[model samples]
Every structure is written in structure tokens, then in C-alpha cells.
Target: MLMSPTNRLQRLADDSSANSLSHRLRARRFQLFEQLIGGLDRPLSIIDVGGTNRYWEQRGWAGRDDISITLVNLEAEPQVHANIQPTAGDATDLSEHADDSFDIAFSNSVIEHLFTVDNQAKMAREIQRVGRAYWVQTPNFWFPIEPHFLVPVWHWLPESTRVAILRRRGVGWAGRTPDADKALRVIQEHRLMRRSELAHLFPDAKIVGEKFGGLTKSWTALGGFPALDRVTA
Candidate 1:
């Protein structure tokens, strides 16, 4: 039998490629998800908002068993088993799926990508519509620097100064669509959400936990960025 992706990941601990960031992020997410949904055996369905097949692959492929992991993205679908289906769609509108179709819907650093305030609110509604619970996490805005990938909390910066900071992050309105830039350009606006801000989306959902990532020593150590994990409406 072929070695599993998680096992392979262990062997790749020393990988030096720059693309390794994506892999490491995915691994961290899997660990967090495993921790959250540890007890339940065979959830009826698990939808990963803006997720990839890498999720199923990393979980020894067992997590995908009986789990309808519908990867939501604007890009083309990835190659995965039937248990993993990729849909080219928007989170603001998930009307394609039946109501209560998924036991859990996961989104990591995705809500910020929404183009409009209305769209972001609609995305929350869609997630709440399809899944029994939502597992969403994003960079905390109350801190300093840009939380994009733990640059620091830039939320404290004034709009004029911060937008310039975001321009440095490849966000420009010159060629971008008004809707697409709502989120993609928020970096300059210092547009991260605090715990209260997130709570507003799902007033009924409680904040289950918060975590500060990194532990120093690592170059990209984001130990400062506060990450909130919530199970809300």
C-alpha cells in the first residue's frame, strides 16, 4: 500500500521549498480540525469552504470516508475521490446544496476574501444554512501589523497609512474589480475582524476558543496573531 500523505508530511519536515508554506498551513489546519471534531465518528457530511483535496489526503483518507467534503472555490476543481467534490461557486450563494446538507462547514482565512459586506454576511448565512455548525477562523484585527500571514496587526494603523501598507502586499485597485477588492484590498483598510466583529455575523454562535499561533524560533512565527475559533449559527 502507498504511504499516506500525513506520513509523507512527516518525512518532508526538512523540505526547503518556498511553497512549503501552503503545506504547513494545511497541516496546521488539519491538526486543528482533528482536535475539534475528534469524538464524532462518521459525520453525515463535512464541507470545506474554500478547501482542497489536501485536507482529505492529509487525514489518512479516512476522514473522507462518508464525509461529503465539498471544496468551495472560484477556481477549477481539484483531483480527488468521489467523497471529495469540488464546486466552483461563491460562498455568498450556496443555494445549490440542500438545506442542512452538511454536519460541519469549515472556512480558514476565507471569509476575508469575500468582496462585499453583504456578500460576507451572505456567506455566513450560507454556511449556517447548510451546516449544523460552522468552524471559522481568521486573523484577529485588534493586534498590530498585517495578519495576512502574521505580518503583525495592521488594524491599529490609520486608513491612509494602512492602505499603503497593503499596496505593498500586492493589493491594488488599478485592475481589480470593485467586488473582488472588498476583501483582497482590506489589508490596507486594516480590515481584519475582532472577536466582537465576527460575533455580529452569527449573533447566536458562541466563541468556543482563541489561540495565538507560533512559538518563536521560526522565521514566519506568527505567535502574535490571535486566532479565534468559533462554533456559531
Candidate 2:
């Protein structure tokens, strides 16, 4: 059966299959993450902002005695592993965690969902304050395709045009929300970041680009880690 463009993109975004593009890219990203922290001799504590237990479990980090992972989201997720702890919190305000409380503050594809650049900056500040080291990733604004919508040039379209498109049909992760206002709200929630913006947000961090077909697909701000020349994804 032939898959539509929307369906094909949704499939590519799915992380359930080890063979999926998202999973493969994430696996490669993890390798770089491991290298950055592997030299440490002590047990590691990680506070994952807007993260899930499934992410760590898939990477075989769950239930490890040497690592403790605290998953933070708007609502606490169901507990599935002893080493993984779920907590309800806002990414923009991680006030519950003390300064340098976690060995690493990690987030993946989350900064862009904050609805505004101001909120994104708040999250970046909080992440830096709470963890001794941090790693944050977001979709690249220059990428030809809008990852969330699975639409080519969707992010480049004007506000009214994006809303109209969303009201007509289901796209990637979002279903058709006939209400114009609701569709507009959904469109406003996702704001991709450019390399310069990321660098400005985390001035202390090194900006790493995740590339596909020689074009950068996403950006990662890496802070307080040993300098590495490159990480190919």
C-alpha cells in the first residue's frame, strides 16, 4: 500500500520502530551524549525536562543502579521503572529543583513547543540554573519541512494560511480541528529555532547541528561538556 505524504511523515516521526528515522537520529545523538558524560566515574543524576520514561527505556537506561532519571512534564507520567521518577512541573519554571541539583539537564525537541521565544528563553535559563551540565535540542527553523505538521514549507507560511490548512485536514501529529481559532492556537504552539537564536539563548553552550542530506535538521545546545569537534546524525 502506498502511504500519503502525511502518513509517511508521521511514520518517520514515530519512535516505536528502531528502524524509523527519528529513532535512528536519536540513537546517534545519544552516542554523542554518552561520550560527553562517559568519562565521569560517579553515578549520574539527570533531570529530563518534558521527557518520558519510554525514551530512557528504549535506550536501555531505565533501572540502572548508577543512574537516576527524573522525568518532568506538565503532569506526572505513570511510573514504570525504579530508576525513573516522574514529576509534574512546568518547563519554563523549574523552581522546584535547586541549583546544580542534577548532573545533567536534558531536553529533546521540547524548547520549540513553548509557544513563544520568551518562554523558550525562560526554560533555557531554568535548565542552566538547575543542572551543572545541560543538553537541549529543537527543530531547525530553516529545515524545509515543518516536523510537527509534516508539511513542506508549512512553517514558512503566514499565520492565516497555516490555520486554514490545519482546519481542512489532519496533518502529522495533529488532527483536523475545524475551529479556526483552535487551529491557529495549535499553529502558534510550535516555533522552530535557528542556530543563532539557540546560541544566543545558551551562550555558554556549544551549538551542534544534526544534519540530513547535508542540510541541518535540528540544533543542540551543549553546555558544560568536554569540547567535541562534531557529532554526525
Best by lDDT: 2
Best by TM-score: 2
TM-score of each: 0.65, 0.96
lDDT of 1 by residue, 50-150 (tens): 87776566556534555667888888476558787788887788888888788787786677667456666887788778876667766555544343433
Report lDDT (Cα) of residue 182, candidate 1: 52
How far in Å is the alpha carbon of 180 misplaced in model 1?
15
Off by over 4 Å in 2: 227-233
Tens-digit per-residue lDDT, 1-233, candidate 2: 88887788888988878889999999998988999888755689999999998999889999999999999999999999999999999999998889999999999999999999999999999999998989999999999998888888889999999898889988878899899999998999999999999999999888888888888999999988654445432
lDDT of 1 at 221: 8
